[model samples]
Target chain A: MKIRALALALGVAASGAVSAAGEVEVLHWWTSGGEAAALNVLKDDLSSKGVSWADMPVAGGGGESAMTVLRARVTSNNAPTAAQMLGYDILDWGKQGAAADLNAVAAKEGWDAVVPAALQNFAKHDGKWISAPVNVHSTNWVWANKAIFDELGLSAPINFDELVATLEAIKKAGYTPLAHGGQAWQEATIFDSVVLATGGVGFYRKALVDLDADALGSDTMKTVFDRMAILRSYVDDNFSGRDWNLASAMVIEKKAGMQIMGDWAKGEFLNAGQKPGDDFMCFRFPGTSGAVTFNSDQFMMFKVGSDRRDAQNQLASSIMAPSFQSAFNVVKGSVPARTDVSDADFDACGKKGMRDLASANANNTLLGSLAHGHAAPASVKNAMYDVITAHFNGEYSSADAVSELVAAVDAAK
Target chain B: MSQKWWQQQLPKLVLSPSFALVLFFVYGFILYTGYLSFTDSRMFPSNELVGFANYEKLFALRHWKIAITNLGIFGGLYIGICLVLGLMLAIFLDQKIRGEGVLRPIYLYPMALSFIVTGTAWKWFLDPGIGVEQIVQSWGYTDFEFRWIKDRTMAIYCIVIAGVWQTSGFVMAMFLAGLRGIDGEIMKAARVDGASSVQLYRRIIIPMLRPIFLSAFVVLAHMAIKSYDLVIALTNGGPGRATELPATFMYSYTFTRNQMGVGATSAMVMLMTIAAIIVPYLYSELKGSKKS
Candidate 1:
């Protein structure tokens, strides 16, 4: 027993010596044009810290493929040094004991003070931080052609009634009111905005965030569905199966008036050399002002060999640094997850978002992003996805959607 | 000279690795998945057994209903069209046609490409803005609308059109091989007996191609059941789940939704459906062969 103990100590000492070199493999789903550009910032920053970053970037915007790969690695006891995880994925993985406790890094960096409470909830497992947030993306923004709105003497709407009036005016002016891709996720995105616009933050919180069935079946939800039905009418006939970038292009070409999508749509605008608030305008979806429903792209460091352990910690620290957050989120077209990041390089739209995030945070109304990531468990979210997609496709009635929503939530449990 | 038991078992030992591979890869994984279906596993497989709950959720989903409906439509049209068109193409090519070798390769080349790549090419061809619709409309048909992909009811047929285009070449190759193996003297005898071309093919050639037909049917049916990548690349089970198939649903449920139990259940449904189709087909083929 004494010899075995001595051998274990020797193994630890040898690993401790090897860890100083700092090499880590990181798995992520960030291979898109803009996403790749954003990920470079993190990789570059890590390199400057003398940490080797082994990038295993899986292609897919939703990280569906990457998650599958991650699961295989985790199941095989070969999880990467770090992995890109989001929202409930953090909790889900943490619950499965697949993630290492990031409390050491969190304590060293004092992350608990600055990170948003909702984000903390997602990144924590039983009071220990498990993931490091990179950027906060609000999914309720309405992107519009500023030139078209200006030419038509239109202003951004602040409420549902005014938004409807704007849609009608845009339609009357011989433009497609809503530039939309008829994919299920795209429909779910629009439905999320409608939920925010018609039902307000409280209803969204009660129905989606809090999972209250009564609020899901409320009159406000019915109005939201009615608004979705109206919004459906604004889409062009051939909008079905169109890619999101193509929909964004309609607005870019001045062929359409607006697109209700996440802040990531800014990447498309930027890619087209269009300046925010000049070529296009980004505003909160009507009636959801001062309310931000958000999801953060975060990296969770997994437990690996000692050599990778040092590299993972270094990468985590680098990712949270102010410069890296600013540079990464700037390219990512999202606001910095850290509230203290400088906004001097940000455009007018980004500045507005930063300001909105601050206000929403102060007002205790910063809700989790429902449409994009895990605002609920997988079962409930999928059921909600099906019901919303069906409703948008004109398969389910407004009342039926409410009933289905309730049943879906009940069934999820 | 007597050999030890260990020395005598060496040849069997050499073959054990292959047997173990087949047992594990083919059988073990399938059985493991079937075991997972009985649990309430989410994100990862859990040990807690919750019988039939996942299947219940799958059945309750409207998307699954649409997916099953689409599977039926796509499978029926795709297999039916491929069989008929492939037989016709093979028969035409077999009539001592000019450049038959070149034509055979041209017809069979599509099957060589990956389905995802083929689906992308098909998507472009079927796209309303840049494809056949645009070309036809450019030809001055102002009101022409070839937007079958945009219509929920007809979208499955559009997929079927692409599927048939992809698989017909494979079926044709199979039929061509079958035709080549046919005895030339039988055709000569039929011709001498004053049998018409149509009657000779209908009466003798088709009946002689029964084994090939069964092989093609099994191949196409398996392909149809496992159809996911093409649908994902082309439509992504989109237009609000209108074009979803069971395979895509299973994939989405497994990875995107992270409901492994439900994914396994959906996979089992696909397995059972294929079993239902192929078992009857095999039974009929066996019975017919016995009677003959």
Candidate 2:
């Protein structure tokens, strides 16, 4: 309690350093063309506010390498003004007092009224807002080549039966049934969709979020593994070690029938000059229509010094502004974290995402994505990643995998 | 007398900073990592002691087991194949063939490139879709299969193939240098004795090349143990950790999985392994060299 008070006092003192000279050095992993374009919107916005943007991009997908860089920089006491962090990672940094207090800006901007409570849970730590939520990314998506599906005379699968039939029919038509990269994280991405689809949202919460042993060991979980086995069979022989973008390229070239990826895959199609409904189509992975597994990309300011607080405030407000949120998420291929934002500027896919996110929010089917470091801490998530990948690679049977996951998560917790 | 004593101590004083740096960075970090293994450190280090719990977990992990097993397969094949290929290349180059200079450079060019370059080039060259299989099928043979990088059982061999392609050329140069160091008078004497070429090599040349063989073996073993990048570039330990090496495993656990303790334990085990292969060879080499 005393530590919290001291932190708040330090935070107040830091906020007083918001002066006229606004030079912000931002560290992030937004190096892809579309992501970079989206990042420019924020840069321009901050520039209008008289702040200079010093870009520090560490290029690696999934932001793992960027986190390593962040850790080293913080240890060296040269923390940047802002960094792109995922859900629990922000909380982890906040716990270590690496993040600066943003409650001053957060309160003035009515963040509590605008930002979803789910995002606020990560944005704030110990009743203090430390990070700004930028955009929401949901994992349960299956992007398909519209031409292949039209030629096959099919639509998006609505359930497990339909999904199997769709994939089988696509295989019979002599196309790669699934465009997939066989990396551990990619495999786990598909696994996350399968778990959400097979077991209901409640089961996903219990098994992934709560790390319940009984839920992990259940036959429902086994069924998910069975589906994963089928999905694994759909990938081509050259899928191993292929980049996620290359897999998307196969779909783009109409060589593959479908891809089970997050909304970020939308950016790849856009980069390829493909329209959403005409060139490709997307849907909630079968049997997970009303449910959503989401992760937000948040920008967190470090405790660099009191001098950079104004630039930090400018960045925080720019990211949360409804105008900036829509413009950014449109290019970045995610929905806005603020419900107040209008989806008028979005495409068919983005509009669908917004509607589904609303319905999922109302129905309480919205859950943090387990595979993307939102639902659970890194230790538990990585443990599950190991078990999931091992099973996918035929290292363990589904039965043994279930037991292994239980033990792994327990040890990690 | 004081000036003379100061001169004697100058070298030690000049080297003290670097010596202390080595002590703190190399040996000090190793001891720190060793200490970290005994704690329950995760994502960040902590002082909370857990006694051999991390080691226990590291051994129990299925991923670590696969990584160790892969190291055994990778190390054995990488060392044995590189040595044989290197020896054959060196012998062939020593035949005084025309354009030996050009051929030597051609064979040694791969050594000039890094392991990363070798792995990537091999990754494309051996890929079924865009590489050898595609080229073969384009020649009107439809059913060509060269998808070892994609197969779970054969992925480690892809790493092996790339590693050999990168290091064997260097090894050839080592053996070639050794062969050049041999006395031509002995060859003339053996020829006068009516000794066959095969017999001469088996009796004299092979035995005389023993020290070079030991040196090559030590170097290759060390390279095999520390091989992380080649495997990463070629397979990235994918198809579900099929080509996982000890180094990759240590990295995954320490940085990605937030299991620093387990990662440290894995690092210690790797240190012990490299030591087991190197310490004896090193001791023998140094002690024997000193005696001679």
TM-score of chain A of each: 0.94, 0.93
How does candidate 1 fare on TM-score?
0.92
- Candidate with top DockQ is 2
Every model's DockQ, to 2 decimals? 0.66, 0.71
Across A174-249, the per-residue lDDT of candidate 2 in tens digits comes to 9999999877778888888898888888898899988889999999999888889888888886787788888999
Leading candidate by lDDT: 2
Off by over 4 Å in 2: A1-21, B1-3
Superposed model 1: Cα runs more than 4 Å off: A1-21, A305-307, B1-11, B277-292
Q: How much DockQ does model 1 earn?
A: 0.66
**lDDT tens readout by residue for model 1, A1-413:** 99999988998876633435567788998888788888888777766666667789898878878988998999999898888888888888888877777788889988987877777888888887778899999988999999879988999998888888898999999999999998777888877778877777778888887889789888888887888888888888888788798999999999999999989889899999998877999888988888888888888878777656767778888888888888888888999887877899898888888888877877888888777764777667777887887788787888898888788877765
Residue range B1-292, candidate 1, lDDT tens digits: 4579779998999999999999999889888888889998888888899888888888987778888888888988888899999999999999898899899989999888888988889888887988899999999997888888777677788789888888899899899999999999999999999999889999999999998998898889889989988888777776667888999888878887878888899988888888997898889889989999
After best superposition, candidate 1 residue A16: deviation in angstroms?
A: 17
Give residue A340's lDDT in candidate 2 (0 to 100).
Answer: 82
Overall local distance difference test of candidate 1: 0.85
